[model samples]
Target: MKKEDEAKSRRSFLKKAGLGGLSLASFTGASAHIGDQIAYASQNVNRNSSPSDLKITDLRIAEIGGDVVFRTPIVRIYTNQGIVGHGDVRDGAAKEYALFLKSRLLGENPCNVERLFGIIKQFGHHGRQGGGVSGVEMALWDLAGKAYNVPVYQMLGGKYRDKVRVYCDTTVSKDPVEYANRMQARVDQGYTALKMDIGINLIKDIPGALINGHEADYNPYQHQSTKYNMTKHPFTRIQITEKGVDKLMEYLDVMRSKIGYDIPMGTDHWGHIGVNEAIKLARASERYNLAYMEDVIPWQYTDQWREITESSTTPTQTGEDIYRLEGGFEELIKTRAVDIVHPDPNTAGGILETKRIGDFASKHGIGFMHHHAAGPVSFLGCVHSAAATENFMWLEHHAVDKKDWENLVTGFDGPIVKDGYVTVPEKPGIGVELNEEVVKKYLVKGEKLFAPTPEWDKIRAWDRLWS
Candidate 1:
């Protein structure tokens, strides 16, 4: 066949195989000679992804604030084919986690996702520390998906569901009636399931509610950094009196009166109380039929989690702070510590890893729920992973009230969440692009948008796990 005819046939075959029109721009940028063959940018698509030739040219990150979580570190991985993929560090996590891997990833093909993830997985640890390696993994999947012109979910063995059911986590409220009304409002707004903070503060002002009290000067609302908040559940020795359980039940009571048992509700932020208090709260919440009692104690306390799950009728959950499946989830799932395994995709090693966790959990008859409270990038990455996860119950939608949150990324039609679920996107990569103008306005203080990081481009330490 003639050269033109041959090119046409190849394009036709690729299109038929669901891998055409990648439109990746090559012969420009950093791509000199990638793989065995050469490809070029086309007029119709303009940008293209040459799968075999795709190389990670650069990785840049920006910390975005306002409307989203406190501050979510977003990463953009640029490839040789002019295809840029987006990922996000867990909200409140340092961008350094992802940027620190730049030297290891530079010049490697983005399509070698599993191989590359193994290289960087060593850098990830549990909690916010895992955000960096997880973010890099997200961007790599996005890059690989784009390179093949398929959605991220499709790359993850396709999706099991068309849309993912979302559970919105509402703000904390002190007043019993007011908190109930807030939860009701979410139900009215089409959220089928809801999660709210049922913490000590709700009953703190009530007399005889708490014992071994929080310090007066410390504001428990912005209490994350406080010495009081820093103490682990068991060490705090904090106790919630019967009155405290009564006051908390009042919140659940009032909530049930407003929204009733029809709406699936989950309670979280049950405060710094220990095993006995956690059991009390869980037992008190049983009559209300809460979806689960989340983070009853630190996830490291597998025995505590098993205790809570066994003691109460209500479901038990944890693992948002856990990293890879091998990190803590293996023990949690195998031992059946919690009824539901909650993982934030950005904090749990991104899409594939999170999906793997869910898949593993499903075999043992445990359900996985995504704990998402980040920007759209991380949220959508969770959405993709959740869609692919067969037994995932419901994914958390923390920004239900943030009107501008969905505007941060373009690619989805209408609201990202509608009627308590997010439609699985069919677009390539993570399926969204940052609305740069809107994103620039939300830049965290002193943080630039996708800034250069030549300093991080150097390998600082020997990363070998074995000599």
Candidate 2:
């Protein structure tokens, strides 16, 4: 009588619950019961948020000091559904770039990431100007991932690797051995690839090593506003003498001797040397077997880049400052101008666009590399992007020397880069939250951490682009 009653109740519940097609007779005492069926049916369901009904309510920012990771501003996109997404404006870019976009994003569904990206992408440009669009794009991906309960890379069409390899972007030193020692420390810390700046400044004071370089007075990294900083490579007429080439060789020789040639070593900060001079240095670099000579000339110089690449055995690379595909990296990849293309996701169009850039480069027989010099918020986004890129070589880690770098974000298991790689995050969204305590300590002078910005709440323009 008791078994009959239980069986009848199970059939009744299944009929009403719309699972009547399943059978009670197929069940055993330990499994296949109606209760078990109910539990299994709901295993994939999440009551987190109504993702489709989700809407953006606000956008806020927290500006951190340069030492915390290139002084990049972090943005938070709030939604009516009680979830928030985090992102980082490109290094050195003003916070206004992202704040200004708030008016345009208000009341929109952040889950429609690509669509919203297209809506505001017009306001973005090359270099740091693209920070606003790129940062917001990252936030949207985060929000969408949370709503869908999937990893950001999973939302970006899945991943190609379980972990993303990182290369140490070693701190610059005028002394080659000092720089090499810092990089050796990274190798000891388990880095498999390395990069260092070996610029004209190293040989600047050496008489007869350079010609027409007297006016080149400022360090491009420290002083971008100066005349020398604004001038292009070709315009500077900064020619390196055969002696200068030898002087550069000495640095490479010491580096190779100290760190060895087993791991890939790339070079950057060539300073504004022209196409011919870059080609000369490229030829000189052939003997050291450099992994690449980064930004030998500016990215816009496609013709000049091709000239340099074709003229030397040293691999050439550029495009860390490019924003989008069509007008940004298309010409370089199509023309086979560089052996590899690198793009910082924060400045290069965020996650998906960078993925597209890599896919496009791979189609052209070019390898893809990641460039990152910002805080961990954007660094994690770059990790997801790199994991999704099939041809990815190495993701640049500018904070390898910053001991507290990983502490800037909370809820992560271990150091971001362990044994020279960042494990692809399995958690939803970009995978971690900003550690508020650490962030407050490093906030830019007047900026609060993720402060509310009601001042940018109103859209002021008739923003339609065309008829």
Candidate 3:
């Protein structure tokens, strides 16, 4: 074709594809490279740069004031290409836990998620010890999603639901009627699922409700005694008497009658009681058709969990404090020890691992519920994972009463929680940015917001645990 004809063809193509604004002056000098430049520009339109070249540049921390129970720390992973990702360290965990991983992540491509996760996975442990590595893992997924111009759930494969069902963890009141009234208020606010604390602590003052307390001077609610918090389930030797059981039953009966059977109800915080007592409480509360009895005993006691699962009509659940899927939750799911596997993503090795736990559970006919108590960063991580995983039953919304909880982050198209469900965000990454103005208001006293973490930028020792 003639040179004028070639120019005319190019113009027609650009205009047809809505690239008419792109000047053809640059192509005049180098006709051979015109097609290449156009293709590159098309590829780079939505992205800052080539996704493969994006590198982790820095990691920073911010501690925001949480509810009375905790001060939550948020993590931000910065990349060379200007895409930043957000994550939340487990509530009450140190910022140093996540900062220490900065050395491991610096100059590495965030898109190689599994490779980066494998390199840092050794640093994580069960419970709060896993906060640092898990936080870093979450930031990686967010960065990867943004780099590719897709939502995190799409990067995980695809979504199973657009809105993840959320259950509020309602505070328990000592008075049964008051507790029922409080739960009724949550239902009035459009929550379809709820969980409340059910334990000996509520009736500890009543005569004949508890026995063997004088031996150790154990206080159920107060953790002043080392014997109460440190002792394991079987070793505690704590028992609830028939009168105590009756009081708990009465509380459940009142709650059930108030909420009715249409909404599912779950319970937790059993005050570190033992397997036998867990069974007794489970059997007594079975008539109400509770959603699931959570952490009745510690998650490590798989056999005890099996006993509770087989003996009671109530559903048994555990694993919020557990870590990793292969070793942590595999036994529980494979053995059918629990009806539901509840993983708090901040403690469960972040989003991908949590989804793996849920996928594994689905194979065994078990349910999945994510336990969440941090700020919006980790909550959205759970939202993305819940959207990707098939077995998800619900994600915990612990801040339902905290009117300002959703304000900590921006970029949400609508209300954070609508009618007891969080819409799975479609924007890149976790689909939100830190609302710096709101976050500044909630910074913990004496703590800085996204402060420099230079001290953790170097590694002094080899980290290999095996030859």
- Which candidate number maximizes lDDT? 2
lDDT tens digits by residue: candidate 2, 65-144: 75566788899999998999999999889889999999999999999999998888888889999898999999999999
lDDT of 1 by residue, 1-467 (tens): 56686566555434533554334442223222322123332224525767888788899988888765568888999888898988889888988888889999999998899999999999889999999998889989888888888999998998899989999877777877888888888888888988888888776676778876674334443545547678888877778888878878888888889998888888888877789989888888888898888897999999888988999899998989999999679999999999999998888998999999999999999988999878888788898999998998899887877878988999888888989889998998889989998899899889888988888887878888786
State each candidate's clash count.
6, 0, 0
Q: Give the C-alpha miss distance for residue 192 in model 3, angstroms.
A: 0.9
The number of the candidate with the highest TM-score is 3
- Candidate lDDT scores, in order, read 0.84, 0.87, 0.87
The Cα RMSD of model 3 versus the native structure comes to 3.8
Rank ordering of all candidates by lDDT, starting from the highest: 2, 3, 1
Better of 1 and 2 by lDDT: 2
For model 2, the superposed segments whose C-alpha errors exceed 4 Å read 1-4, 7-44, 215-226
TM-scores, all candidates, are 0.88, 0.91, 0.92
For all the candidates, what are their Cα RMSDs to the real structure? Answer: 6.7, 4.3, 3.8
Report model 1's TM-score to 2 decimal places: 0.88
TM-score of 2: 0.91
**Per-residue accuracy of model 3 over 1-467 as CA lDDT, tens digit each:** 58797777666556745755556554555556467647945874774657989999999998887452257888999989888998999987888888878899999999999999999888888888888888888999999988988999999999999899999967789999999999999999899999998887787788788876523345443644555667776766779999989999888899988989999999988777788888989898889899999988889999989999999899999998888997799999999999999999999999999999999999999999999888888899999999999889999998877888888888998889999989899999889988898888888998888988888899977998889
